[model samples]
Target: MNYSVKNILLATSFQHKISVSIFYPENSSNKSIIISSATGVLQKYYSRFASHFSSLGFTVYTFDYYGIGASNSKSIKHITANLNAWAFDQAAVIKYAKETNPEHKIILITHSIGGQLMGLNAEIKLVDSIITIASQTGYWKYFKGFSRFRMFMFWYVLIPFTTPIFGYFPAKKLGLFENIPKQVAYQWRQWGIHPNYMFGHFKNTELYFSTVSCPVLILSFPRDLFASKASVDWLASKLTHAKVDRRHLIPADLNIKDVQHFGYFKKEYQDSLWKLTETWINENS
Candidate 1:
């Protein structure tokens, strides 16, 4: 069950450098997993989860997007990287994982916005399977009650107002997540404002989603205020060519209070939720 972690800098096609960590298991399996972090979440947030998977014999890769975490080379204001740039960065990581372990089957594990990036990549076919945790379209209409109004303000009011003034989205200062490049914040705002999310924003999104043929398991929690069941289902339905299994988890059913937006990655869920994740990966692999 021993494993070692090594950090490396990955140069993307856009010339942006990504900070990546590869976990090597003492007894490696034929399956390798690349975990894509949610927006503003650091690669380090998944280190323990990646290590746990490595101990189970899977080589795991984790990385930060171009303007986030260890990949940030300069001030966020100076960074013009958008969603496409982040997707390209992820594509580079996938290519590196494929080249580094050519014999292994690659599984992509994504959180929130991380799951949405795969459809944007032409190299998604290289992934054998995908597991998306709370990944959903961010269109505010999908939410209900107070959550919808809050998200509406987030997209329409907060983002547009603050991004221009600060030259970046100061999410860290507001205690939301990490600070984000203004371009990313703007593009994300447009997507959230649209009814169909990214699919409505771009012309080629249907083709992008149709290209993915791998089996996908999408996990959503009822307690997650950010990703509603409707939003998750909207995303799941868009994966036209993939065999998608979307599960809506009720926290109380599992004898837990909640597994909100970021709780799934917490080490406390190792025995319950993590076990389910490992079993799914094995079955899908």
Candidate 2:
């Protein structure tokens, strides 16, 4: 229940400002980590989740993606938005964590698309471990006819046309696009697809899954609209290491109707994740 808040910036050069925010644990014994958010909301929205790790003594941190949060969404205008660039941002945050908290253990808690992206460029190596929650693994409805076509449109047309206009549509009209960058929006559409959309990033995400060496924990929900148990298991199978753990299929007991993807951040399951993280960190680290 106790924490500290600090504004952060990690830059390659004095001119490039990388914005981030941190929540440090009370009576801490652990070091630090980077928590990647899903499509909507700011770094602060994950505060309760971060509090779990921080409260257990680990410093928890998060940042806005180039066109997402508090960071330079403007880069969206010029750079070609792709999966790799986001990994670079994550790597930068890892670097900053190492420099800022020299000796604390480091971990990567990547959610959704962030979890699927580590293998794009091949340079990620600082985190001690990784935890991917409700992340996309693969989506080849066995490469059926309809699936392949959806992939074509998201990658070739619709995303290319629409992302430049909407980077991440907010749940409650979050004003997430006031400073929308054309290029970033374009890239997001290419990467971001409705779960049931034609064909999702099955091959690419699996490729990245194979390359990550750190201990990994893959949490998947059975009722998730975005990711399924089969997808998480596919990712786990690809990891060369045996350290991959599974938090299998958390079901939402919600009165509403769905236990769908990204619900780990919702009111129903956030605390469950907190407990899982706390217990996992305690047992493992």
* Winning candidate number (TM-score): 1
Tell how far residue 225 is off in model 1, in angstroms: 1.1
lDDT of each: 0.90, 0.61
What is candidate 1's lDDT per residue for 1-285, written digit by digit as tens?
499999999999988899999999999997899999899999999999999999999999999999898999998889999999999988898899999889999999999998888878877889999999999999999999988998899999999999899999999988899999999999999899999789877787433678878889999998588998988898889888898878998888888768989999999999888998888888887
Cα error of candidate 1 at position 3, Å: 0.4
Q: What TM-score, to 2 decimals, does candidate 1 have? A: 0.97
Total backbone collisions, model 2: 3
Off by over 4 Å in 2: 12-15, 73-81, 121-123, 138-157, 163-211, 252-258, 267-271
- After superposing candidate 1 on the true structure, give the runs of residues whose Cα lies further than 4 Å from its correct spot: 205-207
Model 2 error, position 24 (Å): 1.8
Model 1, residue 141: distance off in Å is: 0.4
Q: Write the per-residue lDDT of candidate 2 for residues 1-285, one digit (tens) a residue.
A: 577878876663223455788887777676686887665446767776776667667888988766555776454445344444566676678777877787777778878767755655243566678888877643533133554565455456654555545543222343322333454444455444435321254454534555566678888766554466666665566567548887775354433334556567655554565566666765665
RMSD (Cα, Å) for all candidates, in order, is 1.1, 5.3
